[model samples]
Target: MKTMTRPRYRLAIAAVAAATALTACGGGSTGADGGLPSNVSFGGGASGAIYGVLATGMAEIVNTNLQGVNARAEATAGGLQNTRLVRDGELTFGLTDPRVVYPAVRASGEFADEPPAEDLRFVMNGYPSLYQVTALDPNIRSIGDLRGKRVCTAAGIQTAMLGELLTPYGLAVGDLSLSNLEWTECADRMKAGDIDVIGYAGGPGAAVLIQAFAGSPTAHIVGIDPDKATAMSAQFPWWKPSTLPAGTYDGQTAEVPTVEISGGTLVTRADTSEELVHQFLTALESHFDQFSKVHPLASYYSLPGTATNTMSDVLPTHPGAARFYRDKGIPGY
Candidate 1:
């Protein structure tokens, strides 16, 4: 294991720049219903990303099922920016990871410069994004095995989570030659053999991983030790134990142990009227089939108990969403 001399992590400057540029833009105006906006916007994340794709699907579902409500997905930077947008009411709802919003809620991490988003509220849980430690090297089978390897991952939660994942193994991000690049670029570098490992967070069959795998015949997902996976879940409730079943990707024949955090979460401000949130959930549940058809990852939200399976302890559910879940007889609502 060799430690690098330079800093290990770098924030995604491109994403921050994108968020700054879009800050001046605003969503639709409020409708006649108790300050609820007539045109609802969901922060879809960077265009064509999984979260963005799912957000677009959700927008269509709302536009079709809810009367007089115009919903559309807006292409923003990513989760962190989405949280800021939702908190400022620029976006009616934001599809982001639970952990991504925690920083804003507590005014820590990337959001340390901002005020605590006390009004941030969860609308509903979305698909689970598993932390996939993908590597083109077949020998890289565990987290500790990357000590001296070249690594690449996106900024924000992925970088932080990867650091945390390495901590218990007595390694740090600095131990590897790490670079922070967008997922697409990371895949490109993997294809070029510019990096040995590319850690990513997305759905099991995420296209990014597929592309990275296609770059090399030896590309495979490295499994987290089962005991470490359990420890991580117990330590961080948002990181529940999950498995990438065999054949999830080419060359991945054995089930790989991993941890998953559900995101694609739609969150709104607490002040958004109860009626509006309730109506949105009703439409989503009613036309789940149509909504899921928008993207394969969208179907994950249709799973049993999806509505209330959010990070309630961090970002509490909005009254509107809670009421809807209670009416549907969901426990813990």
Candidate 2:
């Protein structure tokens, strides 16, 4: 296994510049209800990504459920960016992963120096995001097998999570030829044989994986070893061992065990009125079927215990959300 080198100074400088540009353009104004308009804006992932679609569907659901609120979903870089936007009040809401929320809240670890953006709160859990490790080589069977091979972990949060996911298996970025590419780019690289494996953490029924396997029948999801998966979960509380059942996609027949995490969170500012948060959840529960119609992933949003169970531990539930749960016999700390 080879280690990944630190990104060049030029790349770091460019990233800073890009972040500044985004910060400047992303912030929006608050609406009359102290909520952004029903046309409230949501920050989503890259174009054509599942999170992007999920955001659009959520916006539609919110807009349809509330009389004055109209939600609009916009493409974003991903979780870290969305967190920053939501904290800054640039977006009324956004979809984010539970793992990313932890470091940001602790104001240590990866997000050190940028203290936890305390204002964030959860609306609901979207889906389960399983870490899928796929390789073009049939001989590679586990995370450890790709020691010297080229591995593409999609950019931003996905890349960060992949690094964390491999730690317990004794694999690090240094062990493989690491390529930080976008999911679409990673899929394309895998199809071109430029990368030996692509590690992705995404909502169930990911289109990217489906397309990649369809393009190259040789490409397949390499199952994580159960013992390794269990150990990884113990090391990272946010991650739990999970499986993707067969029939999710063509040629994928057996349930593959892997480390899983909450796919998305509906977050809002802490200062937002409790009444508004309650109203939002009320609307969501009442029109779940309408929301599910917005995106297939929304089906998970309908689970009975979805809201209370999947919230990121790092984020304190909004007072509004806490109240709603308390009424239903789910205690809030």
Candidate 3:
């Protein structure tokens, strides 16, 4: 048999933990030693994606540090799916964005098919999911420049957010020839001159952006003009102003102004035991130094940032998480 690396071995252990935890997805059973669940099902993002990697690392940390709690990260279709699963109690914990959770709370936008997930509770903050507007045409300096150009917005959550982004410029998705392709396909089309622009959202060093930028010399990320970014943030409170500093990517020598969702909010049901949530936060805090090594995006997180901006004001923090932060004197909690 081939030798499995340490990471792979950890994930294999988590897979077995997941199988044992499946029956407990409805709401976990308390462990004998503590009020915390004996098994935990954490809904992570798409398989092989960055969010998935973060979720896997988190579970590994918990399993290694938090005795009596078995945490398993399960692959999911990203935030939207994770939100629904968490709301319905099919997942004990989930990773998602405040933007995605906000709409689900109101039962609007992509979540219109289901009732409002009013019970969703924010546990912790992750990192920014900044929108990177890239184009192969150097002449496309601003969003307005793509009036009649072919644009690919990826699809689902991204398509909706990008459509909203165009509104401040007096442009709509209909104004451009739109394609709902996947990020990989968008990169390919952009390279082939089939698409004029790509609207994608992810952490700074997202893999798809790296692929798109490397494939075409002309492909470069464009900044959202300042006024538009401000207006968009005003209209969508979940968005925060962010700057993509110079040299963030190869050949990109200047900073770019952008608006991003404070993504990676760890959410759970409101009824989750306060002790359990507190214990969960404790486990994460103790392993903070090692987390960045597990995933680079985690480096963006800080106690102050997490306490104040993990989720929007509209979403309430669980009492357990709130207590944990308060005890640590993390200011905004």
Candidate 4:
């Protein structure tokens, strides 16, 4: 929403083994081990999206590091969508963006008409990326050029942000031939010459965007005009300035200006036991090596900025996660 903080987190990882041991004290399904419950479903982003990949990687990390636990990442819509799933109990935990969390908690912005999911709780926020608007056509450059193009965006925050992305340039969501298809579908359509542009945000090496780069040498990132960036910050102040630096993705030699999006926040319903969440965090830290192995972009998950300042904060932090944070002396509880 409008008041959400620019998602920032700094995981306090000064001592890993001790932190892991302390957090892993009991919990999980095992009577003998501090492992998570079996077959837990983790809400990743929509299939083939960055969140999906990250969730899948996390599942593996949970599996490899925690015994008696069978955590699995399930493909779901995305941050905002996952928020609902977690609240409804269909998902045990989910990765979400602060932008979605703020609005959904208070039932404002796009959620102003929707009911609030009051049970959601924060785990941690880390890993961030910027709005990377891509187009294979050389004619597409500024956000205004997207006016008549078939731009792919899914439901939830994607559409909301797209609307905001267009406003500074005097374009609205209606100005574009918008496609609300899933991430993979959008990528497929782009390759089939059915779509003109797609905008997404994630760390430097998201798998889906990388595939787009490999599929077409013509793929190039579009940069927002300096004036537009300033204008966007003025209205949707939650968005902080960001840049997809040169060489972060293939076939690009110049930095493209953009706005930052929230990194992943592992969350669950308030009813989830404190012990379970605590063990989950413990496993997460203990398996950092294996987790990072899932993707180059996973490197962004290291403990860092983890709170919502851009968005309004009415949701309470999970007691388990909060306990761990306090124990570690991590900043920005």
On residues 166-193, what C-alpha lDDT tens digit does candidate 4 reach at each position?
8988988777888777677778888889
lDDT of each: 0.78, 0.72, 0.78, 0.71
Q: What 10-residue stretch in candidate 4 is worst by lDDT?
A: 2-11
Runs in model 4 with CA error above 4 Å? 1-40, 45-49, 60-72, 109-114, 136-140, 150-157, 179-196, 205-219, 306-312
Per-model TM-score on C-alpha atoms: 0.86, 0.82, 0.87, 0.72
lDDT of 1 by residue, 279-328 (tens): 88888888887887878877777535567545677788888888888888
- Candidate order by lDDT, decreasing, is 1, 3, 2, 4
| Candidate with better lDDT, 2 vs 4 | 2
Candidate 4 structure lDDT: 0.71
Model 1, which residues run further than 4 Å from truth? 1-36, 215-217, 234-237
lDDT of 3: 0.78
Misplaced by over 4 Å in model 3 are 1-24, 29-34, 310-312
Q: Mind giving the per-residue lDDT tens digits that candidate 3 earns over 1-333? A: 111112345545654565444435554534445477777778886577777888888888778887887888887667777788788877878888877887899998778889999998888888888988888899999988878888886656787788778878999877888888767888787788888888888888777778788946787888888889888888887777788878877789889998888778788888777788888778777878887777788775557666764454567988888999999998766
Estimate, for each residue in 121-222, the C-alpha lDDT of model 2 and write its tens digit: 776666788898888788988887878889887555667778777787798777778888656777887888888888888776677788778856666788
Instruction: Please state the error at residue 142 of candidate 2 in Å.
Output: 1.5
* Residue 41 lDDT in candidate 4: 67
Instruction: Pick the winner on lDDT between candidates 1 and 4.
Output: 1
